[model samples]
Target: MPPALNRTRLAWAGDLPTSRAACGMGFVSTPELGHEAVAFGVNALARLAHRGGLDADGKSGDGAGLLIQVPHRLLGGQYAVAALFEWDPRARAIVEAAVTDGGMRLADWREVPLDHDSLGARARETMPGIWHGLIEDPGVDPDEWERRLYLVRRRAEKQADQEGVRMYLPSLSSRTLVYKGLMAGTRLADFYLDLRDQACESRLAVFHQRYSTNTMPDWRLAQPFRMLAHNGEINTITGNRAWMRAREAELEPELRGAVWPEGSDSASLDNALELLVQRGWEVSEALMSLVPDAWEGRGDLAGPVRDFFRYQSIRFEPWDGPAALAFSDGVVVGAALDRNGLRPLRWQRTRQGLVAAASEAGVVTMEPADVVERGRLGPGQMLLVDTRDGSVLRDAEAKERAASRHDYALLADRVLVPVERHHVDLEPLEDLPAHHALHGWGFEDVKFVVDVMAETSAEPVYSMGDDIPIAALGRTPRRIYGYLRQRFAQVTNPAIDPLREKAVMSLRVLLGARHGTLEPEGGTDRELLRRHHPAVPTEYKLLELESPILGAAELARVLEDAVVLDATYLPDESLRDALHRLCREADEVSGVIALSDRRSGPFRLPIPMALAVGAVHSHLLATGRRMAADVVAIAGDAVDVHDVACLITIGASAVHPYLAFATVGDEAAPRYRKAVEAGLLKVMAKMGISCVSSYRGGEVLEALGLGAEVMEMCFSAVPSRIGGVNLDDIERMA
Candidate 1:
């Protein structure tokens, strides 16, 4: 069996690495098409060769690639070219058939020239046959031609998957082309003869030298994905992918199957960007909406800019992490950074109309006297150059342009209603002892964890590491939280300082159905504004909160128009049955479904909070109702920060730790909530994530002793190594 298949046979060996990467990426752009641009890009990649990994042979690199404007001069203008890796003749035939089936003519097939002798031993063993298939133009505009080509590529991909034929399409676009492989950065042009040809001229080139830290390196995984070359990792990729999957039904018809499951984090980002571009969004505008800055507390920004980011946050969560991206769409080339600015990207402009940007400053050699301007991208900044009009827009100008495209302030004002704050008196619980026994709280929990947090408004610290046995080996049964472990950033990516970077982090959450993106035919600004106004009865009302912690008054406000579902199982009912019942009940509602475990008693046991939240979340996603309702967990078993974080990670939008509040009493309740918020921010920042919206549904935990069935039913997509107790054991323990 292949390694991919064999790894799934045992639970302990099934976990995949977090897929983080530290790499070198850059781009070169000119006012006019020229061979020098391509040469400059290759030269920049060679300078960054030290950033990539080398095989034992020392000749092969982890991965390297170049994305350039379509070489119309070399391929002969008026045709769409597809760069593909098809080793099997049958797969090649299927690809040709897919082209013709889409009502296009297959004009010719050119075998891409390669220097096989230059490849290392390991690279030669895995190299696929490279070919370029030219499809004749069908007398349509360039936009229509690209759209048609996209459909054809999707058809070929689906057909190949159905036939079990291995094939990889690096790119199929009329405006851009990609050439990449498993070779050293210096050898990229040496291996691909087209890069050395004078006719392969372009105005823009995006290049990448990959260093695979978490995932396996392969030829198909090389960068300069369809639209961008990315450095660093997308820490919230798991949650991003999940949300994308949930919102598939709302996507335009042409973007139904846009995201490929086998693609890496960078590739997924490229797919999403490509989809947005195909939907008529400008490249810079789409990127701004996807990776917005920290506008919540940035009073320096214009009101419109803040409103634009606020509106975008409701529809899409930020793709948070440490990222420095170089991207292009043939006509426009640019670079952007994430809010944390964990990666470096520098740019320089020369007097001769040449603009070069790279991970380092000296990649493109130039005379100091000829240098007109030079700068580096700060956190959440962008630099764009438009080849069409020979225009350059820095961070401020680019963002203002994007913000001015629509009346976002008006749209946000009409749709978003802030949750009103009010104080509510609390009474002490009369049966505190019985409640403590029922919820599995020991005296030490209050003395060390709860009391300390109440006094200091922060998490308590311990000097020595934990000495107790893992939950699987312990003599006493533990809560479900104990069987899971949290993952943090390592060498490839740096963990953020939550205290120093608190300004960039956010705990804000929104409640209500998300407004779906406009369809391709209905994307006018007027239509968008009309769709979000208060007069529109079809639009869902949004309730915004500054934090996920809900006090008594806030909880009452949330429950006024919300559906409260019991998260308890009767003596006769199975845990699975109770979960399914709750999911069914949630499916019937449209906004704010609250899952409360407060009803658990001697006659009924509470379903584990993680299991219940994960089940309902997965079910709603499958039923296409996940975005229609927000999930708030009213948990009784949650007393610590870890428990609340676990709940949110498994799809809880917010958590109300009723038991923690009851234990700490009223005066300390506010302080306890504050401590939990601080702890949650620390947990998120440790993984390099910046916001609660991105952290929610991230499923970053690794289950230590969960059974396969339990994982599949309750914790789908979460890695559970070392499978142990079954559902029956969990139920008995509960």
Candidate 2:
């Protein structure tokens, strides 16, 4: 099987690195390089282990696909996606950081010298586990890995506790998958990974995600600290550290070990200063005193502050190199990097209402603002995120640097023009799935589809729940259903012969309750049922409980009974829970329909949805594990197919006829594009080459009864496809 289809392999090695070898100390395969890297930015890096490239060119020219999480008011939700490489390396760093290649400890490091050769090899080995961990969620099943983490943290926590210390929570939010990459087994490593555990109280966020012990005032002592994440190499780092250490050559804070192990240089510098934050230097004072952009201020500064920068520069200039960095101690997420703004960094208030910064906008929510959003964040800009006061501060005069800088040699790099963008002109996006409606499958679609199979036909059903959602959507009129409440009425005839008026009337209930047409409570139920009731999801079709188990019930469906999941909430578990709940409610009377936003051959998830995770959903659909197995046993022989629940998910990359066919129409009306593109693909069994031609006219009208099909009547006219058989009917009959 191809790599993407292989479900058993630990995809984590391909994601998060665990061994020092993976982090860069070990072996790695390099790809032939070219312009692709230059076009895409950092995505050109196939395997992004920290490297001191020998005159390496930095560009995402390899054309790694895009990943982002941006605000979308339409669904009242956030849009997030991750492809290869856009991951947080900190998860693995936090681990491999325990020991060094020489078996000798290194000082706290804020920036890795880009020229160091060994930095690449040692760090390379530590990466695979990071990739592996990010792609593979520690399943509900406890295997050795979970046990190992437990042991490690337990031992580490004990070490901390003995000295009044702390450890990462079992939830491991700090073990973050900041970025990831892999498309059908292709390698992916996009950006630096920085993660914070998902806990009300964060360990990394709190006491020590970034703190490390260092020398202070001729004696060692425990001290609070400052943290920094760099996007560009700070060329001045070595000299700066050397000068600072000379200033306090004698002191070794005993608390250095308390915050971090000994010899953490960059960390010590920050920690030593943090030791002074409360005493005199405000945060700006401490940071400016350490990594001041330049001595010149817009105008005024306190004498000490002004005098401090003037003296600091005498030692060395500002840290150089490009960087989009962020750091926090659970209290404040502060960021400062090279004064030149040589590296890309964008920060903005998140939809969660928290301040965040990353090399890319999607890291926060994939906002374009992530990349200098419409010219925000000029050179010398610093962003301070104060969780304590819920305030954000910018340098204000930062943009002036761009105006002052020399321009004009012009004619280089295809005449780089600053692109202009306003609110997305959604009109051009018509016929693209999800203009008004959320475009992918949710939790409800799983059970609703199972319900459809159980109620649709008497033939032994082997329908793949990984089939297209539109197929399930069209089944209602044909004695088909993806859920019990589909029609909101009980089937009067089990055989459902010819599905006449009475049977169709039984469906009146299920079809009526869809979307906002009706409510789920008694008042609406009575009044609506009196005048016109919903077509019971059950009466429309009987569903099979393939596994006697499932999860989508909570994603967006109304469950037949109250349900609670047994699995422990792990990383990203909150999103999963919220989805489950959404399914339970939204898919109450009808079968749920999930859609994929990416090009997953079979899977689709909108936000933070890893590209290859389709298998997770595929496995769940096949096993029906989301629903309790007992539910299947109780139904017994009555239902033709054995299943606890069902799912009907359209592949994220599936041609969306509704959206594709739209030439000009919106939520209110739609007109599909006239031009058609023939997708050349390899078909099954014969497996040579095949062409699937699609268009915008009659075929779609035929599907909606507003158009007609011409190709031997074997095509669907949904705006997206030109000529095709009605796939739902095909799946059922096949």
Candidate 3:
């Protein structure tokens, strides 16, 4: 059989750490094209060189790059440029052929002049031959020409990958070009000789000096990406990437496999934004959709703006994390901050109509007298400068412009249907002793965990640290959740105080099919109308739940039409075989797949809820059916906050802790559910995550005792170092 889809090479390396970094990034824009914008960007990079990593030699840096409007003065505007990393003659030939097949003529090829002496020893060894392929446009409108160029680039990339050619196109557009490499920030302009040439001028320039964190430094990993330069890490990138992969079938043909697997979290975000822009979304609209503000609890926002965020939440989860972004599409330049405002992005405007924004102030040196205004972007704020009209838009004006494009309040009202709450008769356990034994509920669990929540409607607090031995080293049997430990933010990424930041935190979960294409095919007016004003299809429906913790009645109502799968193993079945069987069964079902261990008896063993959920979730992802169904775990062993969080982190949509409810009895069940919900939120806050949607499938845990094989089969995306037990050992322990 083929390897599991979620299996990554990083797992075999014994680590699956998430990317985290605070890098130097900025942009400079002018009302008119000139050499000053390019020169200012290079100067900014030099000033921020301290924020980037440097090799032992001091000459080699993490990465640095400059993204600027196409230098019409140097290359002319009649032809579109493809800035490529093509070292091989064969690869260049293949790219030229792709351009020809894509219905474009290769007008000329210009070898990008470079000063090799300026590059460090390491960079020189890894650098590819840089060149610009100028393709003649086929007498079409500007929009059509851009679309055609995108198609050609995608086609060329696919062909190059298939041919095993080491080629990369950093930018391919008539409007913009990129000059970047793996070198010290101060040497960027010196290495790329074109940046120093006066003829290489632009109206806007987005620059970046990367500080390597999760991945090693490479030429292609340098920013700014085709559209943006990012300063902070994407904390929920694992889930974000997985969700995007699940939606591959729904993507436009040209963007089918656009996200590169080897790219950093910043690159992934850029890829998503580029796809949205190519599909007709305004740049600000797409940015707002991806990294929305804390609008759910804010009474200060306009009604339509609140509705806009709510409507967007249904289609996409916020890319929750610390982020400070600077973006431009040659004409309009802008900057934005994530909801948390974890990174600094300061801006200043000169009296000469020069607007500059960077990770730090003073990046673009201007005399104090020339500074017209200076400010920093607050949390969930944006600043845009449109060179065409010389219009400057701050947060409110920019967001309002995008929000007013459609009647979002009406759209949300028509599409988002809240899940109905029903009061069902609670059925008490007939035999207390039998239930306790069957579900592994002990005296400590009832007294310390469940009873406290039942009485106070709050998670139980303990003063001392955990004294019990970790699962792998303990002699007693342990659940799968015990093998994994929750990872919290530290150092560079600050953990949020859940109580203080309650306004930004959310537990809302939307259940049902997501709309496929943002832009419809054929490009007809009717198609465009449907794209902008979307409503749930007649045959489909969406159910929104305020929290993932389900009460007895809520669980029953949700499972009424859900596909129930048995998560119990027969006496002869191995744990691995049972998990595989459960995955196979769940893959065949649509809508909700409820994996329940309610069938566990003296003759059958209950599969650990986390294990079952992780297995089935990864299986569905591998088969590209993950988006088609939601996994709601009706678990017997999931009795605490950590247990529920583990299930969710491994891809469970919602969790019903049946055993906890049964132990607490009917009257206290609601309190128990609320307590669990509160605890779940605290867990998310500890990791600096704001929403449960982004936390789902986030893989924010570290397995201390699980063997590599076990991790690969189940928690494939989670970090598993100091490996110990395998499947057989796990089965024996169980």
What value does the lDDT take at residue 497 in candidate 3? 82
Q: Candidate 3: misplaced stretches above 4 Å?
A: 1-21, 252-254, 367-370, 420-425, 517-538, 572-574, 722-724
User: Which ranges in model 1 have alpha carbons more than 4 Å from their true place?
Assistant: 1-21, 252-254, 518-538
Tens digits of per-residue lDDT, candidate 1, 1-734, equal 00110111122111322332468899888877778788877877777777777777766778899999888888876667888998667767887898888788888888999998878899999999999988888888888788778888888888888889899899988888999999868778878989888899888899999888767888988899988899988888888888887777786554567777677888888888887777677888788877888888677888878887887787788999889999998789999999888899999887877788898888777778888999999988899988777688888888888887667776676777789766685545668767766776767778899888888999999999989799888888787888878888877778899999988999989887765653321134555545533233235667888888888878888888689999998989987788889988988988888999888877878888888898888888877778888899998778789989999988999888887788888888888888999999999988999999999988878899889977887778789878988788888876
Number of the candidate with higher TM-score, 1 or 2: 1
Clashing pairs in 3: none
Error of 2 at 630 (Å): 81
| Cα lDDT, model 2, residue 511 | 7
RMSD of each: 6.4, 30.6, 7.2
Q: Which stretch of 10 consecutive residues in model 3 shows the poorest summed lDDT?
A: 1-10
Candidate 2 local lDDT, 1-734, one digit each (tens): 00111123233323321221101100000111221211121221222222211101222111111111111221122211111110233433433232222122322222211212212332332323222212122333323333233233323334444644322221211121122211211122212221111111111121111111112210011111223333332222332332233223122332222122242333444443443332223444445444555334324433333434433322222332233344443234455554444445555553323344444343222344432322235444566545445555565422122112212121111121122211222224422334322223233332343233333322223456545444334543321112111111111101112222111111000101111111111113455435533332221221222111121221112134223222112333343443344334323322322322222111222221211112222222233222111111111001111111111111111112222212223321111111111001101001110101100000111122211221112221113233333323322232
TM-score of each: 0.94, 0.26, 0.92
Reference-based lDDT, each prediction: 0.82, 0.25, 0.82
Highest TM-score model number = 1
